[model samples]
Target chain A: MVSIQNLHKKFGKHTVLDGLELNIDDHGIIAVLGPNGSGKTTLIKSILGMVVPEKGSIHINGKPLKNNWEYRKEIDYLPQIANFPGNLTVIELLKMIKDLRGEAKREQELINFFGVNKFIDKKLTNLSGGMKQKVNLVLTFMFDSPLVILDEPTTGLDPVSILKLKELLHKEKASGKTILVTSHIMEFVESVSDRIVFLWEGKIYFNGSVEELKEKTNQRDFEHAIATLLTGEHV
Target chain B: MFKILKYSFFDLTRSSWSYIYFLFYLLLGIVLLFLNNDLSNAVITLMNVIIILVPLIGTIFGVMYFYNSREFTELLLAQPVKRTSIFLGQYLGVAVSLSLSLVLGLGIPFIAYGLFQSPAIWDFTMLLITGVFLTLIFSALAFNIALSSENKIKGFGYAILMWLLLAVVYDGVFLLSLVYFQEYPLDKFSLIATMLNPIDLSRILILLKLDISALLGYTGAVFKQFFGTSFGSVISLSVLVLWTILPLLNIARIVKKKDF
Candidate 1:
């Protein structure tokens, strides 16, 4: 339900997204895979209107996203870094977000699912990296928005939590929610994402299912296929 | 905007620095009043302190808050809120909280000393107004500097340089120019120079209102002739307003194109 055309973004002399175009119409897990500095986060932020494109247009659900904010109400974002205000308790931060976005009863359910109820009263600064990531996930999923854009959602998660996250993604996908995610873990991406959009040099290089990517790259292994895509070596 | 402002205000209110700043002014007011034993005299003392100190505190606090709240800012950016509202709300939060500290801090002691019953109430009010204006002006400028500079140390350096330039270096240069051009008619020049610096403009505004121009010598007389009138106060106050507005406008404009 998102369309981007001729998107161009630059930071100083370094061009992040140049004449790039992307479209997302499916309602399932879409893992955006790219190497470091491949404009993955830039692309996501562009859709969220956090980064202003030098020259291009973005549309959400057929409506132009130019100078618009109301469309964000339909989207929930999980930033790569869980850098919350340290002084706020977990519950206060959740309540603050709820207040900003209007009421949402799903927060309690997500909090329970994430098992962050014990850290509810503790300040965010005191939480471990994994706990902070759990809190971030709760904030992102609690809103029950139609679209969710998660940037490296699995950072600092324990194995059990990662499993829990995969299950959570499956549940959301089953509910017909369009989820956009970007991550480096090939195994996690292979297991969770139904559609893979591979990015190279700020442009989409490949878009297909896991089986199709394997057939094209001639590598049965998912991680090796991504490596082949990057290295351009015959498998 | 108000929602963001509310959260920011609440966040800042909980920070210990706000309390330290508030208590500083409160203690300063009480000590100055008890020591000077006169409302007018205490205001004069406060005028000197506020003119120099308010801008410094504003610049430091503004930069610190902007850098510290960066993660929080990014979190808010992904939300449905408008870009300008986030920056403006934070700016107002810093400025208003500081102004509150200055008012209640100084207000407590002065009112305790029966400031309202004295004829110097207007002078006291002018002092606080100038303090608030300086706080707003410098904090907006600091936020602009912080927004432009991504490096925290660099942002802090620029902010402090800004305060030093306006508070100290600007006056030094102003005095040097006055001396170098002694043979020329420099009344208009000096008045314009003073008007350009918010700190100087505030000092002149309060000094003239307190009728302490005699101690200011020749330039004071010239300033007295101009700032002593109602027209001069209106113009000076408007310029102060302009000072606060221009930086805020720059903030809005810069934030629109900024990457983060």
Candidate 2:
């Protein structure tokens, strides 16, 4: 379980995260939906301990998150901007990450499932955008870490690769691995997420199961439901 | 510590073929130092290059390496490893690579000259190796500033300022003071001033090695009397080591507390 308590973060005169609190447990995928500059990225980075908060604290798996890097070993993150050294090939990148984590075995089945094996030997810089995203997804799922955080995971992905990634996430979910994903794509979020979190103005406006959000907002579809909840429209 | 050292050497060795250009320049400098049978002029010319050019090259290389590896540093910081390990890895990597290049560039040719011409010249050649490490100390200081700044221009600007302060301004301040204190005893004070600049320290040590410390007149005599022996050799080496240690510790603190 991951818990954030009264977290506050500021950059000089402006506040990015304002006394925010959240709780997540081992479950199927939870999707955090927010517009740009809404502090979604800041929240994820804070969980990873990449950004220090001025107030409050976070705990993961019964341990304080700050400076407790042992908890990070259990979490795998796929950043929104996935970048790697251009000189390294896809296979070499996988190998390096595996070696760094000292993991004895990795799940390479995603590679074959996603059709990435055809160009696994090619340099990352030479691959197409969708192919690179596939590689990033494969690497993130390489270890069987309990908590996986993927930001904009489906961006630039072709239809087939996108379907394959959704299938992979489902399988990981079935294995009881907790997943937190942030994406602006409504349909993708609706298909995979069991719970939805809405962030507006650096605070959680809503948090509940997708069905509950639909019933509470009185909308026929998740897209219209989100629009009504965000802009407060009756139609 | 040992893991960092091992990986540091590996990182340097990975770029072996590419950095041969650095080796080439080093060899050229040494060959130019010993083209003549007369050792005095060659040593003087070599000292001039070591005192001035080596630090400049070191600063450029160090800054470029840190600036280029920014992403890798961010990735490393995200891992479970200790911040000190990351810093020591980077520092050792830069220091050892520069030191090896120095040895290959200047040490080999100096040794060959000592063997071919006269064995007694070996002491002076060893003194030259000491100066190479002094270059590493100054280079490490330049690297710290480059790594801490995210803006490339700002980082490079700070690095150049450090280079100028150690390489030129420190000496300029001392030389300007000489005119004002013409009557006072400034000989002992000059040695103290050189301590603030590694380039000046290299010049003083190399000058003393060539038995030309007397050229500075009364200051020369005082310097030689104070630091003319093998004990002086250790002090110079310690001063260089201090430069490496202090900057590395400072950089480690900044890196640990920094939000990447």
Model 2 lDDT vs. the true structure? 0.75
* Candidate 2 residue pairs that clash: none
Worst 10 residues of 1 chain A by lDDT: A226-235
- Please give the distance, in angstroms, between residue B193's alpha carbon in candidate 2 and its true position after superposition: 2.6
Q: Which residue segments of model 1 deviate by more than 4 Å?
A: B216-220
- Per-residue CA lDDT of model 1 for B1-260, tens digit only, reads 89899988998999999999999999999999998898888998899999999999999999999999999999999988999999999999999999999999999999999987999999999999999999999999999999999999999999999999999999899899989999999999988888889998888777767777555545556777866656667777899999999999999999988887
Off by over 4 Å in 2: A232-235, B1-21, B38-41, B111-128, B185-189, B215-222
Question: Candidate 2 has what TM-score?
Answer: 0.90
lDDT of each: 0.92, 0.75
lDDT of 1: 0.92
The TM-scores, one per candidate, come to 0.98, 0.90
TM-score of the first chain alone, every candidate: 0.98, 0.95
